[model samples]
Target: MACLLAVAAGYWVLGRGTPRPTGTWAMGALLGSFAVAFASYAPLVADGLEAIVPHVARLLSNCASLAAATSVLAISFQLNLDPVEARRRIRLRLALFAASAIGMTLLFAYEYMTHRSEQVFALYLLLFVSYLGFAVVDFLLQAVRQSRTTRRSSVRLGLRMAALGCVFALVYVAYKLTHVVSAGLNLHLVPEHSQCTSLVAVPCVFSVTCPALAVLLICLGLTLPAVVYPLSQARRRRWEVASFDALGPLWRDLSNAVPEIVLSPVDSDRGSSADADFMLQRRVIEISDGILALTPYRCRTVQRTAQSLTAADTEEAAAAVEATVVKAALAASKAGQFADEVAPPSAEAASRKDLRGETEWLLLVAAAYARVGDTGQLETVGA
Candidate 1:
């Protein structure tokens, strides 16, 4: 659970902006959860010094729980209520959690003085569990209601996971409440020989497993949306950047072959979509112009040979054929073999409806150009 919380904290801190102060509250909850995990487990280490001061450990655990509850309440209020009402309720919840913490501390100290009496410990447990119940229930309700209000799939899914986590937390609270009430009031509310009292079977589930599952689910809820949105944008940006770069060799070769086709200067900064799109658009235009300039050098026989060599009608095969024709055309132009009666070589540009489609088509051609452009195969095939 501590590991999960720590990872969630990193996501909230490093990932693109999270929703306002909820991120702050989430950080607090993560920290408090870490502290609680430490307090609970640190003494179990056989040689640990914390075991010598067990009362201090209990105090730390109590304080950690208080912090976690208060932060969760703050998150719940903001997610479920209007801004003004959220602020008002935040104050109220803070006071409630603080009072509960103080009561638990006093009871803990009293129980320590009484040599850890079961009754006094029961009172402490009851106080903590009551407020914890309230906090978890509120968080559950808020997450469910807020999930319904959002249309974003990520946010809705995250909130539902959080609400499910709260269900586990409520189970822990209810079990603790029952145990404490029976201990403090000397009443047998739970049936005798119940599985809950089984030292081997159910105690670990009620105590450790439930809380751990709840913490895991809540951590996922806190980080999922933060991760999903940025990841999607990054995926798209990476593909566009790769495609833009892939057109480099073809664009450079064409510009060199037809210097007059060059237009405005290229921008060195293509870190953003606007810059990349503009550069891509310019490159497309220049390549088109270069193709037009070489039209007179195009050979109908070379186009037919290139098509026969690449028989498939797939886009890749078409791109290979186009690349072959371009290479042969460039060679003819350089060798002063221009023929005005080639009748456009019978090869036409692939039909595209938009800039993105044009770019994709060109990407296929550019990739094939690197394979067949300077391989001397164009000469053998077009000879």
Candidate 2:
């Protein structure tokens, strides 16, 4: 499941030019190798039908390992070398893997190889593991080195996770090498767990389980950067959209009350289109402008009623007070008292450092202002 998910995310990253590095495809290759291995495994294949032609699966797996190893090398080292040298090295490695895979396939298809225990199979296994293992270790060193120079937090985190994954891969290498030695040299490092299969066995757990964990860790490392970052960005965009929605009613009401106060006057034929941030900033400005224009119309009755409620100075409490004052002022404006005056009830301009704080204060005021016509009094919010 993880390998499949990593494949999706890694491919998406590759398509978008994300992470700005070859590592994205490398991550996909790591996941792809696991996916191919799983696909080839009899248990995972369609009803285990591949059990009849198991050698074919082995050939595919061999190629996958080589591809994964080359990808790992490409990602681990920075692309700072000469282009011609890089191309030559890549082509040479690819040819090597292709030749090995073809030769192995022919050997298996012919009847020279009967089972996985043969010397040739052991040799192939060792070579496959050695390439991937070397890449894993080299990747760890290069990633750690890059981490020191990497200034971005996300990138640093990705490199560290990848390094940790390499540690698991190295452990898998150790287990595999031990198995190869036991199989090819007829040497058993681990005692037969007190007993073995009537004929043969050595630490039954290491064969399949250990490598499974290594692949899982590698997939997880691949997923972090590819999946987490895009999700976080999506969440942020959603928040911006929600904020815009919450402020919609306030903007509409205020625009109706004092249409002239709007910063960019809308034309009848073509409406002004804007982005979330721009709309938010513009709405705030329009609301402030409307309040400024209605300053001289503050209702003394509303002020007295609000003062009787509370004197708290916290943000919420302050908003309540401000809401009542705006509500009263809106009423006074509608009733035509000082609605057309040039002077304000005060000389001070309200200012706050936080954008959210300002938005909250204005939203509370807008809500109360909306309610004033129906209630005919400042709603005793705090009281």
- Top-scoring candidate (lDDT): 1
lDDT of each: 0.72, 0.60
Give lDDT tens digits, candidate 1, residues 1-383: 45555565555556536564454655556555654664464436322535575556656665676677667767667756788998999889889988998888888878878887879978888888888888888888878888999988898999999888889988889888988888788785645434343424666677657776777687678557867988867776777777768887888788888888978665562435646656777777787788778888777776677777874677777777777777777888888898555625323354776877878888877877788846324432222
Clashing pairs in 2: none
State model 1's lDDT: 0.72
TM-score of 2: 0.56
Query: lDDT at 16 for candidate 1?
Result: 31
User: RMSDs, each prediction?
Assistant: 7.7, 7.8
TM-score of each: 0.58, 0.56
